[model samples]
Target: MKLSTVFYFTILFIFISSASYSQAILQKNISLDVNRQRLENVLEILSNKGDFYFSYNSSIVKKDSLVSFRASNKTVKEILTELFNNTYEFRESGNYIIIRKAPIRMTLVTQKGITEEKIYSVSGFVYDEQSGAAISEASIYEKKMLASALTNEDGFFKIKLKSSKTSTAELTVSKEFYEDTTIKIQPRFDQQLSITMMPVEIPENNTVIKPEDYLAPDSLQVPTDTTEQQLPVSNDSIKVQQTGVGRFLLSGKQKVQSLNLKNFFTTRPFQISLVPGVSTHGQLNSQVINNFSLNIFGGYTAGTNGFEIGGLFNIDQKDVKYFQAAGLFNSVGGEVKGFQVAGINNLVQDNVYGFQAAGINNFVTGKMHGFQAAGIYNHVSDSVKGFQVAGIGNFSKEKASGVQIAGVSNISNREMNGVQIAGVVNYAKKLKGLQIGLINIADTSAGYSIGLINIIIKGYHKLSFSANEVENVNAAFKTGNSKLYSILRAGVNLSDSNKVYSFGYGLGSELSLNKKKTLSINPELSCQYLYLGSWDYLNLLNRFDLNFNIKLGKYISLFGGPSYSVYVTDQDVAFGGYRFPVPPSHYNTTKFSHKVTEIQP
Candidate 1:
């Protein structure tokens, strides 16, 4: 009796577990009542009450059609069957119920037994599963042999397949906006079949989330999918090639093929094309990633893995791996990993990892990790990690960590951590490096600037009044950091008999001598033109000084130092009302003076 009781309990437990595991969401009981509403709304109501979700294609079901139904304490399967008029099927996938059209039954028309010929033919007619209508332009292909054919207007297609050791071969039928269908058949026989295809379905909750949802309005963001993870060829994949240049270069048929064959891509060893739409691969060239591509005039392709050359221009919809060259221009919608050269321009919508050289310009919308050389302009929308050289100008919208050399100007909108060398102007929003140009501008700087005019918006600035041997009253303005500063100086002697005036430019460095910065040492060099009652003869004064600075008040300081001066003149007599400190020389002569400067407030 004990053994029998234990056996009975075990059996009961097994039965209950199996019942729970095998039960499907379709068998769930729910109550739904609608007088007249949209079919989509009705499905939503059912989903809410049933505590489940519905996944169906919008094309298969007329979402706007009026639907009226009543079901109380009925299974989901029964309700769906009655609601769709018994024309659809219900399936369970995870926690959601999938609604699809009922697949039409296929019948074998004719078949021939094994033949002597190695090549056998498979002829078929494709039909819609829901409406029982012929599906035209449906693609029928074999996987292993790469053999393919398309159905005509009458839905008739015939494809030849080579027989091998395998007894059965699989045939796949696909069309735009349709679910791919595959079937197995004996490879040795010539067969005729009737095939049916279903429409692809998307989850009702599938949505595309743009990057602006969490970013600033002026910031750039790429749109992404909010659904589950997917492979490279899913519907959620972005069409990066839908750009302004692509619209003008790529044909409409090529664009359509790119959209329809998102889940299909193959590799080819070589491809040749006279133009974009006219290629060796026909309209399917956009779906092929070739190892080698050559064009007589111009070409368009999905991508390049090795080498590609064109006579006029080259357009690639995807990434470039090794090398690409063109006569007029080269446009790539994806990342570039190798060398790219063009006669006119090189345009890359994504990042670049190698060198880009162009005759006219080089434009990259994403980050650049390599070098760029152009004749006119080089522009990077994001940051740069390498060098940029251009004849006219170079611009980086974000941070720049490398060197920028230009004939005209170099501008960085954000931080700069490297060097900028330009003939005219160099600008950085925040600088941590060095700048060499005629004019250098920075909002904030922790580095040095060597230019005729260095303007740091938030940097050091001070005006000082002092007296030197050359003139009685002197005034100077200094700007930049303690490490490096620029000075503009002018001095005038108020004596009515022998008035002297001077104007000059100089550079200085300040070093702190105490922890509190109360005492400091300053070294400066300046060259000035002295007006010693003469305008026809040259009167130049050059000086070097070592100053001791003592901070007195919050905005005041007392500074004095020893100076060395050299005076050169070529005037035999005074031309104006003033006379020279010493007798004027008939020939060029130098006079030296060494003295202590007078401290002034």
Candidate 2:
């Protein structure tokens, strides 16, 4: 056959198959009236009305049992649901509706035991009821308290519980593809129990013509009901499981253990491990939550509830409570509640509720509610509510409500509500607090920035050209919030006899005097160096000015105010070898200062 012809035929086959499945008898709407009819007779009537056959094992349904119901234009599913009390499932095979019992839930197994002490300990082996074989990794838990245990390779498990008010507590055993079994036992003593779990059965074939023969003579068809149902993990959980320590440090067996117990957790008193796979709990290490864990080299487990100390590192599949310390690093997949200290690094994939200290770095992918201290870097992907201190840098992807201190830089991608103190640079998208650094920047700010250069992208900005007494032609640029700003200025004395060049930096603040913001008071302090043609001596000039600003237009202003000058210089010659003019020590100089300036910024 040609390729195109083959492709067309394949598409046609799929369409026909889908059509057959979509027209299955269970979905067809029907009107039925029956008053306490025998179950078998009702099935026959339904089969005839839907033009299909009912198939099942004779013992599966009580044929002689009386069922009474009336359905008006209801789907076969609805009718059958009322008949069987929703305890059966139906599947279509050709024209047959194959009936089977739904998987049983919470089968109770009760046993009487002698009560002895205040501590209750239970140990057991789980087995398959049909084959009389051991079932591994079956979860046995007390649902009310979330105390659980998992069967190991030998179908063995042990769990400890405290005495409760009731004489008996129920423990549920569950595994994939098996019926849930609940067992009731004395909660005040130690006992051993054996549990047998039944596997779910699919409805058997009972038709004259099999589905495989009807579809294709040579191929066998597997029923869709027999496929395993896999529980899905969330995207965030998957990201946490794919961390560097989870991938490289955990053994294949440990990973498998984590996957098997994704829906359950079991508590243990204590555990010891030489490495990830070799532990006191053997291959079931990652499935256990322990009170105390001592790792000779390192260890991987589900969680820590009390205290954990490792010689090298510790990797937890879930939350860590109390205290956890390691020689090299510590990685947790869930929340941290207490203190976590490490020699090198500490990584928490979720929130941190306590303190974290690391030699090199500390990272929290979720919110941080306490403190973090690191030698080099600290990062929190979410908001921070406490303090962060680092030798090099600290970063928060969201808002920071506390304090951030670093040697080099501090960054908050969102708002900074407290303070940021850094040696070099500090940045916040929106600043509602204070920032002290060499260079401070913000998109918009209602707070103060103390630095040599402060830039608020959406706040205050001004450029001015003015003629002052000492420097004839001067230009200055101001940037920051209206409350506080930094200025960079340069000037040149154009006079032939006393030619001088000056560059300076200053700090200023503006205060509005009226509702229209047309008039304002500006107080500025600046220092300048006069280059009088010689680099041989010091020439420093300091000035303080108070300027009264009046709005002239939308983008223009007029300003003239009194100024104070203080000069300290040792230079005797100007740049061209002209005698440099030195002002007296206690002199005050003032002249009319005018400019094409921007005001009310």
Candidate 3:
């Protein structure tokens, strides 16, 4: 009887242990009511009940339609099984569960049904699981190895990697709009694989994130000094728990910088680079810096102290000193002291002192002190001190105090203090110097401009009609600023055909003599072709005059001038072709040969 009792107790103990293990393995109970909720939302609700996370294929799972579910103190397994039924498969991996479509595994049969361990090439094809359609541009990589490949347009791919002793590789497949699929028993044999991926169903409430989320600090931020005991570590450091820049909901530009980044980067004496990734900054050859540097392709670092050269490009984080030359591009962050030259572009962040030359473009954000020349365009934001030249265009935002020459156009935004010469057009908000171009435009002409069309907002424009001693009715149109003006005049007689029809153009200016009476002086020079008959006649008249003007009102002015004339003609005519000599008429014999016509009207 005692033996029987012991046996009974042992049986009871085993039964209780098994029961306890089942209870412990059971998932937590959850109670919630969801009304037409998305599958993603339902998964989220399930995850919140315990320490479980769900990963599923979005394309296979329908998340757009609302799902209605009501469960009270139900196990998670029961709830999920009821929701998906036979439509998907769930595999638990630690705290995570991967959800995917029904699996269709294909196996290879070796000769004599014998499998051997050996290294071999691997190839594969990726396709959509639901439709069996080929998926292109899908990335495939071994989880633990550096072997990677991408699917071609026909969904074919190949990769080379070491064969695993276990004859399996963890292959991870991912593509745009598709859920990631991993093959646990990855093929290491000389065989092909057919991978199927489902499209991801995006959830409305899910946080958006790119595939590659760069959460590391920006490269521009300067490192903090750990040597200082008084420095606050909390303020200087940045904590990014996520693997991305997750601030996508921002409506406007957000300036986010590490506390230490606002300060300047540590200074360096010199550095060298043979290419972009190979440089002294990355090599850590010296703790401080060098005074001289050289490069074969490109260089990028904090700053330069002496001279630097590159075959392709040169990039500086802050400042550069002495000289720098590059075959392609040169970029400076803060300031430059000496000279910089590049084959393509020379860009300065803040200011430049000496000189800069580029094959394409040169730009200075702050100020230009010396000379800047470029083949295409040259621009200065603040001011220019010396000479500026460009093949196409030159621009100064604030002021220009030197000389500017361009093949196309020259523009000054605020004010000008020197000279600007362009082949096409030139413009200044306010001119305090000289401008020469085909078209010169200014708002206020405090200096001078010479061109075919000179427009000044505050200077002279006049249309005058007057009678002169030589011509009965003469009309002149004048336009310009205070510094210079152009005059175009024409005259004709009413009754006589050969009374002389003249057309002329000249340059002159008005000088203020008295402020009270608005008196001024006008000096002009003109050359006119007198038309006696047609193109068969040859007559040229050059005149130089000095006139005094008196302004009576806003629109009316009186002016007269004494002119010295030189007339040349091939033939002697009535009143259009010839003029008498400069000798006294009393001693001249040809005085009787000339006739003068007087004004009739």
- List model 2 lDDT by residue over 1-601, tens digit each: 6999999999999999887775667889988777666666667667767777777755456666766767899999888888886657777776778777664342333343656666778887888775556898777777555456678989898887778889678887877656787788877867788888886543442323233322221122223233333333333342345888778877554554455456666788999999987887765677688999999999988899999999999988899999999999999988999999999999999999999999999999999999999999999999999999999999999999999999999999999999999999999999999999999999999999988889999998999888776667989999999899999999897877777788999989999999999999999999888787877877777888899999888889998798776666765544564335644223443322221111111
The segments of candidate 2 whose C-alpha lies over 4 angstroms from its true place after superposition are 1-240, 577-579, 583-601
lDDT tens per residue, model 1, 1-601: 9999999999999988766644657888888767666666667677766666677765566666677677889998888888886667877765667777777777754556676788888897999888789988777766556566778889898988787888677987877867888888887788898998876554552422222222222122223323343323355332445666677877655565565566777788989999986887766676678899998898878889999999998888778889999999988878899999999999888899999999999999999889999999999999998999999999999999999999999999999899999999999999899999888888999988877778889987889999866577989888877788888899897777768888988888889999988899999888777787757767776778889999998799999988766666666575465756432334333334222122221
Using TM-score as the measure, the top candidate is 1
| TM-scores, each model vs. reference | 0.73, 0.65, 0.51
User: What Cα-based lDDT does every candidate model obtain?
Assistant: 0.79, 0.80, 0.66
Models sorted by TM-score, best on top: 1, 2, 3
Candidate 1 clash figure, as a count: 0
How well does candidate 2 match the true structure in TM-score terms? 0.65
Worst 10 residues of 1 by lDDT: 210-219
Better of 1 and 2 by TM-score: 1
Q: Give every collision pair in model 2.
A: 532-574, 532-575, 533-575
Which residue runs of candidate 1 sit more than 4 Å off their true CA positions? 1-82, 91-240, 472-474, 490-502, 530-539, 568-573, 577-601
